[model samples]
Target: MPGERTKYAWRSHILAERALVGAAEHAREAAELATAIEPLAGADDVVCAYVPIRGEPGDLRMLDALCVRNATVLLPVTGEPGPLSWARYEGPDSLRKARFGLLEPTTATLPPDTVATATTVLVPALAVDLRGVRLGRGAGYYDRTLGAVGDGTRLIAVVRDNELVDRLPEEPHDRRMGWAVTPGGGLRELGHELPVSPE
Candidate 1:
């Protein structure tokens, strides 16, 4: 139970810390993050992003911002316990309740490999250390999805300002993120020891 214990311990600690974030403050931070990420979207570019659920840092406003920038935003469609399938984000009107209390696009689903076409991938994280080791929810969905991205893709971890930490528990199969975007800090490049390899 060591792995489970470690994972839960970190999860519990961070979630409790996040509980202090008031709804108003959360919305403000989410707005800041939306502004920060807008510049990352390019016209005619495909970007992979997620819709934030309750208690998550950024909200759907970020995705809407990407859409306004003319980027083809891809949202994850949960499936079997492997890499996540993607769906193009049509708009807020196109979202529906999905498994695990997630809001997913009702648009046609794309194959899991569709992530390869993304130029930037914004991932959800509880915390991301300076080394770019992202501490995710124990489900491992982002871990699997990120592993399949093209070598040139920019993997960015989205966390609250204080969630950018000095360190976190890591394993061999763990994938490192290249950047951490915080509500206050904007986009920060991490000094991870191991660079992400497409192999």
Candidate 2:
């Protein structure tokens, strides 16, 4: 079972990268999809996103879209390796260089407390199984942070379509997500959306 699990994770990562490479339409597709979901989600629903590194999910296109709408976008600022702090996205202009190859808000240097109010959290993972188990870059930061999210917040993981698999290796510290989004493809609920509270 362990061998099978490892195989699935590796396969999912490879397939997802390939899918991303083949889908030239992903950037536009993701923006449009996210735009549609913006209003359906409540204003209190703070969205958490990350500044991409190593050409991962390519969310900058949609990230800019979110900013243009003047939505309250939250970016993950790493505290250590296993925990994260959040900053209210003021604008691309408000972002300044920060530790761990990330961007943070210039004015509001918020702590992890902000994530506690997230209505939706967008995460990056190498693979995500049907059970909503996510494989990050070997970091437990989101797992630790997701635990802090207030009730009613839907934790969503964004991955390339092929990254959504039948199963993946789940560590006790790994966090689960309710929905997974991919470019060109619509949303898929990986599991029962968790009940979250509004701030």
Q: Judged by TM-score, which candidate is best?
A: 1
Per-model CA lDDT versus the true structure: 0.89, 0.68
lDDT of candidate 2 over 47-98, digit per residue (tens): 7887665445555665666666556788877666656877777667877888
Candidate 2 Cα misplacement greater than 4 A, ranges: 1-3, 7-42, 68-70, 192-199
Q: Residue 78, candidate 1: how far off, in angstroms?
A: 0.5
Per-model TM values vs. the true structure: 0.92, 0.78
Q: Evaluate candidate 2 by giving its C-alpha RMSD to the native, one decimal.
A: 6.8
Clashing pairs in 1: none
Residues 1-199, model 1: lDDT tens digits: 1324465688888899888889999999999999999999878789999998858898989999999999999999998899999999988999999999999999999999999999999988998888888889888887787778876889999999988877778888788999999999999999655555697
Q: Cα miss at 5, model 2 (Å)?
A: 3.7
Where does model 1 exceed 4 Å of error? 1-5, 192-199
Model 1 lDDT at residue 55:
88
Error of 1 at 92 (Å): 0.6
Clashing pairs in 2: 151-196, 151-197, 152-195, 152-196, 152-197, 153-196
